[model samples]
Target: MNVITDNLGMLGQGLVTTLTIAFIGYACALVVGTVIAIFRVSPIPPLRALGAAWVTVACNIPTLCLMILAAFAAPRAGVPLSLFAAAVTAIVFSASGFVCETVRSGINSVSKGQIEAARALGMPFGLIIGAVVLPQALARTIQPLVNIFISCLIGSSLAAAIGVPELTNVTQQLNLRYAQAVITFLTSGLTYLAIAFLATKLGGLLERRITGREAHA
Candidate 1:
């Protein structure tokens, strides 16, 4: 209790950093992933190739290495970003590939009859995608999106490596400074678990809303 009380402020600060990284990463991933997924299904061979290459290469790379590269290598090469910014870039870049795959899978999961019907109705490709396909895909992908978010939340811990002072980093500092190793680590773990669980519940609600809308449409 003493240790928790003493480190409450620091924990609050760390929580803010964690939320910042996750939200930023999620927004970037959503956009980039959707674009790449569209490209992956493009009629143009080159577009498909480019999308596949990005996903393949990024998915193969380790998240920590990517974060370090974003923080250190890019800077040394004169494209400098602060630790926080680098973390945002790293998480987004890495997570985007996964999101792309998820989006693609969802797109594929939809029935061909709907797309064919849309095309027969003279809907443009963009309209078909935006109006008919995307809505359905988003409905199907909500649960997976939530799962990806939970993973992103955990991966944000790597931000500590770049001196971002996210949850794990702050906990490490508290552990060393207060010599309450067990308490600090346990508290951090519980907090992370709690957030993940809460997110899962919220995601379920979102999934219901999205799917209900799709059914009505």
Candidate 2:
């Protein structure tokens, strides 16, 4: 209690920063993942190859290495970016690989018959995918998508490695100043638990809502 009370402000600020980075990173992931997923499923050979290569390389690379490259190496290459932006960009790109696979799985889960039926009606590829396929795919994939979001949320703590001053970084600094490892770590752990619990609840609620909407449609 004493440790928490003493550092409540710093903790709150860190929490805000964490949430901000997570949301922005996740948003970027969603867009990039959707595009890559589309490419993976496209009839074009080059598009599919590009998508596959991206996911394979991005997923194989460690997030820490990505962060280091984004923060340090990029600057040496004349593409300088701030630490916070670089960290978020690395997280976005890394997380998008998983997200792309998740979305592609969802796209595959849609019945082939429906897609064929759409094509028989003279529907353009874009319209068939966008209007007929994607909605059901997204509805079916909500839980997995939410799970990815949560993973990305937790992974944002890695920003501490790049001096982003997010939750884990702030907690580490506080631990150093207080010299009370048990109290500091316990408090930080509880904070993460609470955040994760809330994310799970929210994800469940969203899944239910999307399912219900699909049923009505």
Per residue, candidate 1 scores C-alpha lDDT tens digits across 17-114 of 99889989988998998999989988789999999999997678888899999989998999989999899888898889999999999899888999
Candidate 2 local lDDT, 140-202, one digit each (tens): 777788777787778888889999999889989988887877887788778777877887888
The list of candidate 2 runs beyond 4 A from truth reads none
Compare the candidates by lDDT and give the number of the best one: 1
Give the per-residue Cα lDDT of candidate 2 at 71. Answer: 95
CA lDDT for candidate 2: 0.87
Clash pairs detected, candidate 1: none
Clash tally, candidates in order: 0, 0
Candidate 1 clash figure, as a count = 0
lDDT of each: 0.89, 0.87
Residue pairs with clashing backbones, model 2: none
